[model samples]
Target: MSETRPAPLAGLKVIEISAFVAAPLGAMTLAQLGADVIRIDPIGGNIDANRWPISDDGTSIYWASLNKGKRSVTLDLKSEEGQKIATDLIAEAGTLVTNLPARGWLSYENLSQHREDLVMLRLNGSHDGKPAVDYTINAASGFPIITGDDERPVNNAIPAWDVAAGLYISNGIIAAELERRSSGKGQEITLALSDVMLATVGNLGYIAEVQATGKTRGPLGNGLYGAYGQSFATSDGREIMVAVISNKHWRGLGKA
Candidate 1:
């Protein structure tokens, strides 16, 4: 007989007061890893509750997919009683994840008062603290301008910024958890959506390319950037992306 082992985040409890992609997705990832995640929604639901990818019967597949493995609760957060309840939950859990423009009762100042060693993470639209979303952030990040071979900028169908922000949120949460374990104290962690885009574009050399040469890489449809790679329709009518970035790969391609 085989023995069962508990999950890595087995005893970790997370109180999530978030909506949309980054916050919910991060909390959902922790829940999947066996954390006790309690997602608090409004009396009806959050903004993305009825987002796209609906089933034939009109079920919110998008919501289900993002919020999977987490427990849900609907509370009238505007009410004083609801705020008190939520404060108690955060004090008990000692951890929170959120991306909303949270202030007042939901602010770190207020929540930390309840539990001094509370770890709270918040996501903002930009470092300037202005309002923005994935598409808005991506537009100025220079990705859409070089995405496709078109006269007009081509926006990504995939919310790449949101996806990346979600991954960052998850990573930040784990780091904060480790810090709490080591210091016996908690701190606030924050990330701006625009900053995530800037970090990625800068790391990929796109920002440097424009500054160094005063020229930007134009769109090369279906081709790998700065690499010998392209997608072709195979004999089976299925499309395959081929790359020959190295001499060895080129030789291997020729041999085949």
Candidate 2:
């Protein structure tokens, strides 16, 4: 018989008060890694409960997909009793993940007061205090302009910024946990959707070209930017994305 090994975060607990993508996704990732994630939704449910990709019975498949493996609790956040319950949960868990606007009861100052070693990860729309979502951030980040084709600009069907920001938030939480082990204190981590998009585009050098040379990159259809790679249709009309960034890859493609 084989013995079972314990998960890395077997004893860890996470209290998540989040909606939509960033924070929820981050909490889900933590849950997957064996943390006991308790997702707190309002009495009517969070905004994502009825989001798109619903089932035939009107169930939100999208919500179910992201929230799997986590325990859920519904509360009336507006009520004083509900607020107290939430505070008690946070104090007990000592770790919180949320993307809602920082205010009132859920604020880090308020929660950390009760538990000095509380770790809070907060996600925001924009760094400049302006509200922004994944779509708006993608539009302003210069990705749409260089995405589709020369005829028109098209936004990505996938919420790339949301996913990236969520992963970043998960990474931040892990880092904070590591720090807390040594420092014997918790830290507040903040992330903005717009900042994540901007940083990603800048890292990819798309923003650097426009800033350094005033040369804006245009749409290149399915081809990779600054690389010899593109999608090609086969004889049977099946499309395949091919990357020939090096001479070896070019030769390999020719041979195939």
Candidate 3:
């Protein structure tokens, strides 16, 4: 039998101060994988406390799902004592994940004073720090133009950018943790929501395509980009997605 090993993030302590999808989800991901995560909120709860998908008694399943596996505390962050508690927690945890405005007590500069090697990962809406969210970021990603069957631009309902940013946040924290372990130093990591979308569009060659061809790709609804994929409806009123990513797969599809 193979030897057993502890979780990659086991024994890691993290503090998360956030309200919505990206930061909370990132922290939750870490918590699920064995990091000890403590989420700090206002006296009652954060703004996403009553977010959609509520249960009959009025509980936010959306928020709960994103924050599962993480311990939570509510404090009056506006008060000096409350700020002190939060700062002390951050200093002890040594890692902070947040998407809130990082001014005031939550600022990296302020927290780093408590622990010289604190790893603070802050998320911003835009590169210049203007406010933005998943819907707004997705609107600028150029995906909507190729999302539907026509060029009218249909935005997907899914918060793809937010999900991507959440994963990126998790990765950022891990990388920072590793760096801190090696160098005995910690640094501030800033991730812009818009930059996630921009990076995705660039990685997918959409920006280069526009530059090289001077035109946007035509709409291809429910189809792969630069590949063979389609959604098919069966006579039994069911739908299935099919794709051929290789020569063997294409031959198998032709045979079928």
Output the number of the lDDT-best candidate: 3
Q: Across residues 7-119, which tens digit of lDDT does each residue of candidate 1 receive?
A: 88899899999888888888988888889999999988988888888999987899999999998888888999999998899899999999877699999999999999899
**Structure candidate 3, residue pairs in collision:** none
Error of 1 at 143 (Å): 0.8
Question: What does candidate 3's lDDT look like per residue over 1-256, in tens digits?
Answer: 9999988899999999998898888898898878999999997788889999999999999988998898988999999999999999999999999988999888888999999999999999999999999988887876777788976988888888889999999999999999999999999999999999999889978889889999987789989987899999999999999999999998999999
Candidate 3: stretches off by over 4 Å: 1-4
Q: List the residue pairs that clash in candidate 2.
A: none
Q: Score every model by TM-score.
A: 0.94, 0.95, 0.94
Q: How well is each residue in 1-256 modelled by candidate 2, as lDDT tens digits?
A: 8999888778889999998887889999998888999999999888779998999999999999899899989999899999999999999999999988768998899899989999999998998757788999989987788787685778889999999999998899889998998998998888999999989988988777888998987888888876787888899989999887888988898998
Q: Candidate 1: lDDT of 65? A: 94
RMSD of 2: 1.4
Task: Quote the lDDT for 18 in model 3.
Answer: 91
Ranking by lDDT: 3, 2, 1
Deviation in Å, model 1, residue 51 alpha carbon = 1.2
- Top candidate on TM-score is 2
All-Cα superposition RMSD per candidate:
1.6, 1.4, 1.6
